[model samples]
Target: MVQKRKYAALFIGSALIVQGLTACSASNPNPNSTGTPVATGTAGDKAQTSTSGEKVTLRVMDWADSEKPFREKFIKDFEAKYPNIKIEYTLMSVDQFQNTITTAIKSGDAPDLYPIPGNMSLSMAVKGEWYQPLDPYIDDAFKNQFAEGAFVEGSTMLNGKIYSIPAMASVPSTLVFYNKQLFRDAGLDPENPPKTYTEFRQAAKKITEAGKGKAYGIIEGGKQIGRWKLAAMDWSALGGSGLNQQSPISLVTHDANYDGKEVLDVMNVFKGLKDDGSFHPKTMSISAPEARALFGEGQAGFILQGEWSIGVWKRDNPNLDFGVMAPPVPDAGQKGFLPRSSYSPWIGMSKTTKHPKEAALYLKEYFNKDYQSVLVKAGDRFSILKEVNESSSEIPQFKQYYDIAQKYSRLVPNPQIRNPELASVYGNYKDVQPGVGDILQGVVAGAIKEPNTALKQFSDIVDKSLDTAIAKAKSEGAKVDKNDFIFSNWSSDKNYSQQDYKSIQ
Candidate 1:
């Protein structure tokens, strides 16, 4: 299947770095965290419900290492309050979680809470009855705590049914994580990293040459090939490829463009880096965690990843100097910007869960102001709340990220959001084998000599899959069309607004 990055996978290392809440003042842009956990949400719970009975264990599965420590602490605090409910949590790789969760759903044994598969659309999740309606459990008081547009049809709500809740703010998953020391050693300026595609390529080759087997130019978690797919999507967007930042489908032409020059050019650079011996020798087998660790060890000059690594490297390898920058773009300059989709829930209640009230209760508190404040205090993620985001602005690293995202991440047109009925378009869409990620992997590994031909073939197959999906949705008496994918008013830099959706009608 054509794969993409999961909503929460990008922030795995955003965990452990935080020591405690820092004493902040308006003057301190980079407020330092201290030595005690004091988020008021956990250690200072105001509403404690002591239920005395047999402890109810809720099964929860996730893929975010970033949320692990906080999740454990939250459970501990929650258990102290309830005293009758326990959380049984499972953390796994994105691939493993999706595979196991899918099997569990098919066997009528799904976990109490699980993330929707990266490959599944909201419509598909709804059609398969993967999540139970949460509306019954959500009180207006708890609901009002969320940001505006937290629930929408074809997203958190489907067909008037609330299926999920917001977990994190929308942020692009791709950014350049580079070693400052490596740049110095390679005779490159640490202050000015590569900005254009050619410069990026040359810099990698130069760094690899200087390393002389001690390090490499770049590293990737090649085992999880979606890493490359995400890099391609984000970097290629600057080329004005028209391909959606999240998928192979184009936002402009409403056609599959996996073979388009934008993506293929990015793929070629990835392949060239491999050919130049700029990739770490173990890049093909290492996981992202392993790669990040290697990068911390100064074994790689650069790693294409998210902003959260700033926290990880600072804590783990304090001596390793590094910097963050946007992925290198085409020499001609950036022609497009990244598209920011709305907040997507990383976890939702399973339809078969027995502890509906308890699970719903936890869901409501998951993104409350208290927890959000803690998240910002720890520099984990940008919260959906304006006030929490304002607090995060005091942290220098997060402030830097805010500037990058501001320039790159703009809301784009989405057909599913415009017309809820069009959700079937994604539900019925079939993903072909050796998808975007695998194709890039094959070319890099020398398994595919003709990368261009492979990409074109994949594009054709995916395009055909779209046609088949449209036909299937139509056959079921849903008004669907290929043309629905296009928003004529939207541009590469468009900030799609609510009014934009209304105007189409």
Candidate 2:
């Protein structure tokens, strides 16, 4: 008998780093200088200060406009605690952050500290030395404060060094948030939510039939091709395909399994939903915000979204009554799971910063339990600290969210999806004709009659792209092999593991 894999025991591994030296020339001299002798120390060591009495201001940059409240509080608390250090907070839009940071770094005007943008691969940033390693400041005692496995390989640790520290826990990419009143109006049981894909489909059909053309069973941002593909893969993963969370390149390159009946079933579900007219009529045309508005206004019964939606919907539609549920599974008895990447964007300092000691002190305060508590209470995001999670009664709503996260979520390893060179190559291919998103959109729009055919085309494109990337990497004398792409012992039923890739190295 084949040994069935278990979800709880999976441990994701760090990707092997092929180090190359790169240097950044300073364009701005003494960017963090206030002529102050600030205190700094390793994790367990007592912070020591110099005799200089001048104050130091640390410039911090991030695209977290919505987290203004938490940011304000953090700065206030941090400044109050450390009178010699002041934080200069700079906010940029997500679209502009990557370019802004890149330009700033190249021109030697980078902030003393900043978040690694979600769109920028961490490996690439590390390779370019965009962020200074935090290893020297972080000792075992400091690292012990975080939950076990909080320090992920690709995002924080690369080439045996700690580059960044995660500020938030891994959040589930897909969750079912349904309006309770809408379910009741549709003659469905609000308390007994969907447990499997079959029940979810039946409920959607019933809700749509009950709408009398005024409401929809589900609402999605179909006009946003990337988001649409994400939803498709999220739902597909719910059917036990496991390929949903992996990048398109990973699928074709065999870093993730692409050939499975469950994968095909996911495509069929999308087609069936379209055929059944279960989606909002404007789903294929409207943006995510518009779709969200429709759902908030009680024009849709259900919407698949992330934890962030709860606060938004509550604020925008104060009267609407809704509840959250885990994503459905392939069968009733099988446990449903939410897919989360092991690594999240972390806060890191720049190598060019002149105030390393003060900056490191600020990092320590930033992730302190007190600050984390304030952040959790403000609902900015969940904390990476284990104590904060254990003492979550301080924020009841967040505690509830944490419960769901702990119960239903599992982390997908980062290395395969986060390989910098491969990701860059895949990103370029994604813009060309017959891209993965294009194929998914075509299938959903009924243009591609056969999902298998479209998927085959997608796989072929991925194969060629992977071949070129691997060849280039090898020619550059990078230590990589085809074996890195294959995980023969992996089981879709279990959470992904580092052991899956151990043999390749």
Measured by TM-score, the strongest candidate is: 1
Error of 1 at 13 (Å): 26
Query: What overall lDDT, based on C-alpha atoms, would model 1 receive against the true structure?
Result: 0.66
Considering only N, C-alpha and C atoms within 3 Å, which residue pairs clash in candidate 2?
none
The C-alpha stretches of model 2 lying farther than 4 A from their native spots are 1-57, 80-109, 137-140, 152-155, 196-202, 205-215, 221-226, 244-264, 271-299, 311-319, 329-340, 377-380, 393-409, 412-454, 496-505
lDDT of 2 by residue, 252-300 (tens): 2364233345556656666777778888888877655557678889888
lDDT of each: 0.66, 0.55
> Candidate 1, clashing residue pairs?
none
- Report the Cα RMSD per candidate: 6.0, 9.3
How far off is residue 220 in model 1, in Å? 1.1
